[model samples]
Target: MIPFSLLDYVALFWYITFWLCFSWVVDHSRLKHHNLSHLMNGHRLRWMRNMSTRDLRMVDTAIISGLQNGTAFFASTSLLAIGGGFAMLNSTERAIQLFSDLSIPVETTRALWEVKVLFLILIYVYAFFKFGWAYRLFNYSSILIGALPYAKTADEQELEIAIRQAAEFNSLAGKHFNLGLRSFFFSLALFGWFVHPGLLIVTTTFVGLVLIRRQYFSRSQTLSMHLLPEKE
Candidate 1:
């Protein structure tokens, strides 16, 4: 395997590139509605033709949410893996201490380290599944948006149906991604704690700030209401 320093640089590079690409996809998707419409035919074309204003709003929110969750998962996991590797290298004594705390035998403790490696692998796997599912949900939302039934009467019933479907889809996608991001962040902190409690405290503080700012103060999210009106 590559050295921890090299791995950190690779992770940082991937995180930046993924963030930029996600942003571009969101912006392009919003601006290229006509192209998207043309690209999709038959059922998809008909659906878009029928979609209500509420459905459009929901679709927009879903796309933005998928991007947010996806970015968070990528960035957090990369940081965790790289940071964990460095921590293990610089703090072997501490790693042993942390891994051997259980009331298990010496043989068991050796096995436990192996298990910890597997645990970390599982965490990444879970994160990837969650992020992948979120992406699929957003894709489904886009398909639903395209398949909206545009009725001339524009009854309250139809609007309600569209809004509810869109809202639920977005919610499902958001929840999965949020869970994944949480897991990634917490696991990183756990690794840091083993390296040094002080480092764990710093990571925790930074993670908390990022979470708060993203939810309530980020430029895109904070002003989302004005940019894209709610369905209700």
Candidate 2:
């Protein structure tokens, strides 16, 4: 049995609550439309709508390829992080020794260390699955793009439907990719757990705030929401 105290439970509970609430605020809140992710979603819709007017689609295919490549990189990184976690589990004594002299909030134990490392591995695994699914969705979007009819030959209604379908698939892929990256950021906060439960709570709160700011108040968000003049 792992030796965990009341403080550990409280810290873990807060960590989970912060993560869930942050996810909701970014992806489902009433003001989510003002965020960077929502802005990019609109850009994706416009990109697909414009694709319908072009005779050649090489530009569209290249952009999809880039999305797939980015997703694949993150998936591979998750696997590597998982392997590192297992390696730490095998060297549990060394990790405990390294922290033995530090003035930490809690004493280190083999069982507790193992649990922390396992949680880290679990997070990366979740990210890997998300990236994998996002990659496949990008592939589906590419196929949908290929299926779009030429604007000159297709009926107006059919072209509109095809454009909407392609845009939706692309947007869904972006959402999953964002989720995978979110896991990676939170996993960094987990390091504070190896030191102290109180520190863990503080670190998680800080990371959550940073993510929220980037999504809603960063320069990128401001720039993404900007539009060019329609005419001179």
Candidate 3:
């Protein structure tokens, strides 16, 4: 096993720290202005309200099915990525030689390379679990949607309560799906680690900036805000 240098350890620690900090800021921070997530949440509430007014909610069911199918696709992709990582681990020597032949200057030993591959596998495994759970939550949300009382038969209060429950479940499933996608984004950054720690830092910063921009300042966020009330 090749021993990691102090810098290598620092790079790994920095990577983890930044990931955790970014996730917390995105999910928990209350900024002065609304982000995409906040706007989407407003839309979710509006969707449920609309659902309560309609006698038929086939469209809503279709949307929920789309979400479930998307989550399942991502989960399957994550599993495939894990399998690819394992395949890489099996051909560690060939991989190392290929890097050497490419004049890529990979300074790590075979053991370190294997460990990095394992780390990648771990990331995908975590993503798979997140996506899998998100898919299940979407299924639950669909069930809740089906359980909602019909507009023609139920009182206003009962309809409101049911809609609210279904909306909350859908929102939660969306949250987990976003988390899984975030992991996939970070995995792209992690690719730089195989080349150099400095490259990893640069790529991580780039990914973080891209995510923040899309979350808070993208055109999609603007459109979502337009869907909300002026007071919001």
Predictions: Cα RMSD each: 14.1, 2.5, 1.8
The TM-score ranking, best first, is: 2, 3, 1
lDDT of 2 by residue, 174-220 (tens): 99999999999999999999888989999999999899999988999
Q: Which regions of candidate 3 fall more than 4 Å away from where they truly are?
A: 230-232
Task: Specify the poorest-scoring 10-residue window by lDDT in model 3.
Answer: 30-39
**Alpha carbon lDDT of residue 99, candidate 2?**
87
lDDT of 3 by residue, 34-145 (tens): 6787678778877887777778888999998888889999999999999999999999999888888876677867988988999999999999999999999999998998
The TM-scores of all predictions, comma-separated, are: 0.48, 0.94, 0.94
Instruction: By lDDT, rank the candidates, best first.
Output: 2, 3, 1
138 Cα displacement, candidate 1 (Å): 2.7
**Model 1, CA-based lDDT:** 0.51
Query: Residue 1 deviation, candidate 3, in Å?
Result: 6.0
Q: Pick the candidate with the highest lDDT.
A: 2
Residue-level lDDT of model 1, residues 8-28, one tens digit each, is: 344434433543443344224
Give the better candidate number (1 or 2) by TM-score. 2
